[model samples]
Target chain A: MRNMIVASTSTLYGGGYLEYLTPFLSKRLKAASIKELLFIPFARPGGISHDDYTSKVRAVFQTMHVNVKGIHEFEDPIKAIQDAQGIFTGGGNTFQLIKMLHDLQLVEPLRKVIYQGVFYLGTSAGSNICGLNIRTTNDMPVVQPSSFKATGALAYNINPHYQDPIEGDQHMGETREQRINEFHIYNHIPVIGLREGSFIDVQGTTEILKGTLKARLFQAGKAPMEIEPETDFATLNLNH
Target chain B: MRNMIVASTSTLYGGGYLEYLTPFLSKRLKAASIKELLFIPFARPGGISHDDYTSKVRAVFQTMHVNVKGIHEFEDPIKAIQDAQGIFTGGGNTFQLIKMLHDLQLVEPLRKVIYQGVFYLGTSAGSNICGLNIRTTNDMPVVQPSSFKATGALAYNINPHYQDPIEGDQHMGETREQRINEFHIYNHIPVIGLREGSFIDVQGTTEILKGTLKARLFQAGKAPMEIEPETDFATLNLNH
Candidate 1:
């Protein structure tokens, strides 16, 4: 049985880091009897040091009486994932995270433990690794990874922090929708545009859309459709 | 001698496609005595077909009595670049364009022609390839290319369509400046953030910043600086 919390953003507007998801996240940790979380800080938000990033998460999880440790501290990262009670990959740069994961040869080990049910939690760049491939990420290519292949924990790709076109904005850059649409030109995988504060609560084979915001779903050769909150993604034919 | 016009965008606010650039573009073609232009439509903005994208450019250039032909129309694309009097590459998806260019092994041929004094023009994704690499691109990682290396025609990378943080915006996604700073974390290469309406005129050994807006210069471990219009980029000690 797989258990996952794939979030669009770690922190919401006017909220502290992970403040909005604290209640639900605390409940999940307690339900799973998880006391310690192995945090993957490879994404390195703002290029903060591993210890600094880990401490940030530690401060939040400490409120729930759960200890947080960064994987970088472990001698054998593969063993750390294999032994962790729960895992949380914080968001930053997807390219940087993927590059390190691939360089350390942790993708396979991480995938194995997740399938065995290690309680995976990911936000932004973290959530991106759960997809079939990171071909839908909105992050810049800050670095080159060995490949775009992700953990494949989920069958589809995730577009986190997905924003709609700004009404009457003068910018010439492509909108989030247009970028995802361009992805469809070369890839056939389904993509879910998770707006800020939105997430997917995955338990076993059932995946439910959480939060108040609606998600946009784009499939190959089909017009994007809006998915309401509380909708079970597992019910949809995502294989297309 | 290299003669090229690398623009941040093809169209500007409240302007038609290439309308803002038409006057300057017309003068350049006439000065070069270029009657026929070779167009590279591989960027495929909005996923438009090559023929359709080429037609759009053709419609505008026809006003100047200049003929435009897509490289795809030629049997030997390498030879097409080698024989063209002038070339224009429209913007779309940088990764897709790089993938095709690499897949077809046209990078060398394109570079050879450009260094040989073939008048070249590029916009958005097109202009991105003229840099040292495509790592600074704002485009989504919709596809995985064999490599992030580009034409290396320019000494530094270009962050096209560079925009400042929207004042008081609620979006949690990284702003263009933050994104570029993150890029500097993993890369030592200098990056020039070209704002909309800006173009870098590369004539011989000098690259001058054109247009009304100021470009942002980012170097490793240094605060980003503002570059005014008509500033020569070659004068900057970018090696630092």
Candidate 2:
């Protein structure tokens, strides 16, 4: 069995950090019977320190009466994951997060625990790791990971914080759609473009698209399709 | 002597591919006594085939009476670079271009030829490879190269297609500036955010910022500075 909430971003437009997610998150945590949550702040957004980033998350979870601790504080992080009732991976730089995950050799262990039914939550870069690989991440390559392989908790790759092309914008950088199209040229993996405020709620084999925004689904050699909210992601053939 | 024209993009606003660059390109080629240009089409913009992409560039250069040949057409790409009088590496995907360069072991040969004053021109992804590493590139990681290590023809990295933050836009994706800042957190290599229409012209040790736009200079632990057009980039201490 698998249980996870993979969100496109920690904060939605005009909302505070974790504010928009709290209601949905509380419901998930409550159903999972998780009180204490272990936080992985390895992504280190804006280069924030581990303790500082952890405190930010702690402050948010505190409102729900949940105890939060960063994984870095633990002497044995592997044991921390093994013992945790719930886990949250905050967003930041995907390269750094995957680099640390590989360097600590925690990918397999984390994958095993999550597949065995541990409660897990991931946002942005955190959500990216839940995919088969980190190839579709939108973050800068601040550092190099040992391997692009990720947790693979989900069958497809996740393109978190996916944005539609801005109308009338003169900037020549490839649009998000163009970039994903190029990705298909080299890879056949199905990619789910999770816009901000959108998420995938996976329980057992049922993965539903949660949140109000629509998600864009891209497959190799096929036109991109818009996936509506409340759509069951499992219904789609994601495994290529 | 080293002679190179590294540009932020191949196309400018409302212009055909290489249209804005043709005037400058023709002058440079004439000065270098070049009749034919060798093209590297591995980047393959929009997933165009190498022959098709090469043909596009060939058609453009043909207007100036300069014959063009793709390196892929040669059985010995290494020898083609060694013998070419002028070389042009067009833009597309940085990862794909660097991957091909590494796979064919052409990085060192290309560097040697450019250093030997072969009159090289690079746009977008092509310009990115002239740096110390591809770490600062704005392109998506559609594919991973064996190493981030690039040609190192330039001491610093290039952030091609650099754009400033959009005013009043609510998109949460990190702006190009913020992305570069994140890059500085893990890297000490200096980055030149070459805006569209801007380029760096390198002759021997002197590198000048050309075109009508200003470039942004980014270094670790320092605020990004706006570099004016016509500024001699070589005067700046970019090694830090």
Candidate 2 collision pairs: none
- Note the Cα lDDT for every prediction shown: 0.93, 0.92
Candidate 2 lDDT tens digits, B1-240: 999999999998788998888898899888888899999999999899999999999999988889999999999999999999899999999989999999999999999999998999999999999998999888789898888889999989999999889888787878888888898888899999998999899999899999999999999998889999988888987647
lDDT of 1 by residue, A1-240 (tens): 889999999999999999999999999999999999999999998899999999999999999999999999999999999999999999999999999999999998988888898899999999999998888888889999999999999989999999999999999999999999999988999999999999999998888999999999999999899999999888998756
Off by over 4 Å in 1: none
TM-scores, each model vs. reference: 0.98, 0.98
Worst 10-residue lDDT window for candidate 2 chain B reads: B231-240
Q: Write model 2 residue lDDT over A90-135, tens digit each, in one string.
A: 9999999999999998898899999999999999999999998998
* Model 1 DockQ class: high
- Fnat, 2 decimals, each candidate: 0.93, 0.70
DockQ of each: 0.90, 0.80
